[model samples]
Target: MPCDKSANADPKKEFFIDVITMDIDYPDCILDLIDNSVDAYTRSEIDDPQIRVTFGEDSLEIYDNCGGISEHDLLNTVFRFGGHVAHDSTDTLGIYGVGLKRAIFKIGNAFEFETYDGVNHNIVYENDLSEWKTRDDDEDGKWRFKVRAGAELDQETHGFSELRITKLKDSYKKMVTLDAKIIEEISIKYVLFMNRGLSFWVDNLKIEPLFNFEVLSNEYLQPSVKLLEKDGLKVKIVCTYNPRESLRSEREEGRYGWNVFCNDRLILLSNTTKETGWGELGNIAFHQLYYPFCGYVFINSHDVRKLPVKTTKNGLVTSDNTYKFILNEMWNQATPVLKYLRTSRLMDEETLIKDAEKSANEKVLQDSKLARSNADQKSIFSMNEKASFKAPDMKPKRKELTKIQYSRPTVQVDKVKRKLGAESNKKVGELTFDLFYDEECDDA
Candidate 1:
């Protein structure tokens, strides 16, 4: 006798939908949609790429000029959970193929997809969550979305595609209304693409890239640049100074420390933790003296799975071997620059003044240094091999300081402190030393 029975192991799609949306914040849902648009533009290699995000009272829309999804991909992969269409993932941010569906479900219960690739012009598809949840599994025991094609073109159909999600959930309603927060998040994540001429708009307001931190460059002060390659991963580390060191506003100070990117998308900004080797590997821990220190690490690979970014692409996979190597090399490249900063900052501290005019003059000097000829700056950035920063020879002549430590009777120290009118035992020692230096130690 043989048994031919199977236990039910199929996942409930309704529960799966809730599980995916549970972990993501509303702002991230919006960013996921923007990521899709940006990725589409990268894949198509479009010259005049543009993305627009619009919000209605109860709906949200995203439109992009990137090439529309091909009919085959849209029907086969786009709607399927965790289904990724094969393509070159280099310089791309989309991986799990769940961003779109997850974002759609997290935001609303109904959506419309209209796309035009010039050939498959005016294709429209619509779906509602309630209907999708009620539908039974098909013959192959899988849920499927019905796609409708050959719709008439609409007024807002200029771009390759436009997606509108309506009936936004109550939880996400206020999040979409925050125009500035959304714009700032987009600016941080896509500053590189914006620099490359891609324009993004939110609520008809164009997003301008936040000015990225740059190091100073001249004959005496050059930033170090190193290129590391291992296991199909390419990491470029640059250690330099923050040009705004003299006038570090709260915002500017926040930009100090390490900035890391993967495939041109920023993942870590101003990280000064031990994860990036701040207090590890015999390096000095982060302090006010290291304010001018800055490091940039950009990791790229053809096979993005080898990259050290988490699946959300918002954080790093610190446990990955590739990331561990990158971190070690970051410390290697940053050591020299940090050493120079320590020396330079100590000198600045010795001559420091609180005059506003002097601070303004320093700012002027910093600006002039930053205004060096573009050709000279290009030469530094053009170097791809191991290079060292040429620190200026500026160590001032000074008497070496020595710590004089000696144990004395507590009563005696207290008597000396009272005689000298000193506030501390250390101060009493300093006063006695000054008296000795003035009366006994003769410079004559």
Candidate 2:
């Protein structure tokens, strides 16, 4: 009599699936697919990179004219669970091999992935997740995607990888139905790409950048752009004011705060928390008082492993050494702007309005073209490793000023204001004071 010598130690595919897709949101699943397409574009020699996403009530379609998956990669690496094949030339956003499979399983039960690399290569892989989960493995007892060489694709689909997902999970269907929000998310997340000749479309409508990543740069006022380089990584930080926005009131609109990018993809947008050093010692707490603040931090490196971003590419690896250095630099660069914002509030209402108008018209950099035009100007100054333009110094108000206040009947106040031909109560008070000074004080 012998006891069972071994136990069932094999890992279930279901366990991996649950772990990978559990914490990810529906929109994030969509973004993972797009990140794969963008990585393809980055690694290819394609002249024009275009990605289109079409949403249906129960289905999703994403197509990209970036170079498609190679047959070698298709058979070896693309469908693998959790390893990355290094490409020396391309720095891409995909750190984990799970993005594609995770997205497919997160969105729907059925999927079709087809690719044509614009040469002689064409491959297609389609499967139902539920059946694949229950079906026995191949003779080799290995789980794998069954891919085959397919018919030559048409001109539109040539050089493109297309994915179609059906049977959308009930809980995730709302993400596709609310297409407008998704489009905005794409516009924000891919802003740098959009600026650099990448075209993205959703539901046949061309997507454009909804948020302008510009700041005021001129003779009177210029943005602070600081560059920090450490161990082959380059970080460029720009902090300044947006001429069109104000700090007078709180705004829930995701139009302000820090915008952080890694390898040209936006990882954080309008981030206003301690995670980005908002309430740190050197930086002011994120309040409506600092609403006019706009910042951009771009981190670029040839090694994707060095970038301080998680596998989701939606947040930072805050504990990363590079990120720690970046956080300190962000604080140092942001201190002056915060000081200016705080001091600017001391100005009187009229002076503040005039300053706003002047900044908007003469001093503000109107467009990206103007921003570039001023690049060679002497206004931009560099110190050591950081390059910056000086923020404006507000003229300090006189400390001897006094305020006069009194309550009067509404009828009397209006009548006196009319008699004095004044538009405001303060004007009427000023006129009455001057009359008394001339008639009584002078005669005395």
Candidate 3:
């Protein structure tokens, strides 16, 4: 009893113990790495940061000229689990610490990293997954990567870091063929920013800029409607009808408008689909009449993230009040143009033949009246002193009317029904409508 049993208890047994086993799967590893590259490039304050992605048969390397990690920082923090030098307070792009490790683990079975700090010259870290399997089991598992002092390079200027991932996953190999195209598209998509001096290269291919819109001065003069404006956000609508072409035929007239951008960089180009609510209106023909062209509403970068973009990152402005107001303003301004397109499409059909025939008949009567007036003027001139006699039928005969047989409207009723059906599926509530009947009808 005098031994003080409580004081004799083992310190280890008295202490709390916690074991965490985290298993995360990374199916989209390469995509995550590319996003990380974008983050690193965008965060660096360098005038023009260069990001190089090289793909080889069994290895992949990504090198960036951004600030490199120090040897001590790398060992003590960078390689540690839950390590994030950049956190929520940081405005930098790569705040999530798990991205790099998960990216590396997904693409390669083994990976190595080399970073340069002016003071240390070069710090190297290598991780071989193959060796982890052979290592002895222990209370504290051995760290995944190896870190050591690296050969010194000249410290007069800042240097870059290189990440080499070997034992490449099969998907990485397929990406080698597509990397060039991806770089080209990315370059074009971000051309405006690219012009500001950001450069990205994949293998030997350099990305080139492709701008979508020309300068404002280059746009043609057309009636336009202004919709919404809040702070820096502005929405303008424009509609134009081409009388020379038929809008009803898909091959002739192409519908335009509805593009989404962030900071003048286009994120999604077109969002029209049958599944979308926009396709539902039977009055789309009326809408398209003004549709040979339409203008887009511009939302500034600050509010862009608020937009309802799909999981695929496709942004769409729906029939909500915000969009409805804009559409109403646009539709009011476009009513005339929409009528024009509808009339033009209608005039091409056989049902409008009666109207065409009436127009032709009016022209014939007008010509006859003109002829009688000319004849009376000639008679009056002949009565005047010694006027030369004029021929009665001197004017040329008008050409015979060419009977044009217009085809039936080819209404595409099924297509319209299918489109409406799809649109109805998107509706959240029930619908009610009133039916009108003739007073003379007694039959039920």
Model 1: which residue pairs collide? none
lDDT for each residue of candidate 2 in 173-228, tens digit (9 for 90 to 100): 75535578779888888887787678899989999885554445666557787887
Local distance difference test, per candidate? 0.72, 0.72, 0.45
Backbone clash count for every predicted candidate, in the order shown: 0, 0, 0
Model 1 lDDT per residue over 1-444, tens place: 769998999888888888988898877888888888887787777667899999889888999999888877777787888877667654677778888899888889888877777566644444678667767789899777656776666656544888899988888776635667789888888877787789999989999887544455666567889887899888888887654553354646325788888877888777877767676665556765566777788888766677888777778988887788788888888878766654444223223322223455454344343433354454334667777876654434334688898889999997665544356878667657755764577543
Order of candidate numbers by TM-score, starting with the best = 1, 2, 3
Ten contiguous residues minimizing lDDT sum, candidate 3: 428-437
Off by over 4 Å in 3: 1-28, 69-98, 117-124, 130-144, 174-176, 188-192, 212-215, 218-257, 262-266, 274-444
Evaluated against the true structure, the overall lDDT of model 3 is: 0.45
lDDT (Cα) of model 1: 0.72
Give the TM-score of each candidate. Answer: 0.80, 0.76, 0.50
lDDT of 2: 0.72
User: Can you tell me which runs of candidate 2 are displaced by over 4 Å?
Assistant: 1-9, 45-47, 153-158, 174-176, 247-255, 346-385, 396-400, 403-444
Q: State, as a TM-score between 0 and 1, how close model 1 is to the true structure.
A: 0.80
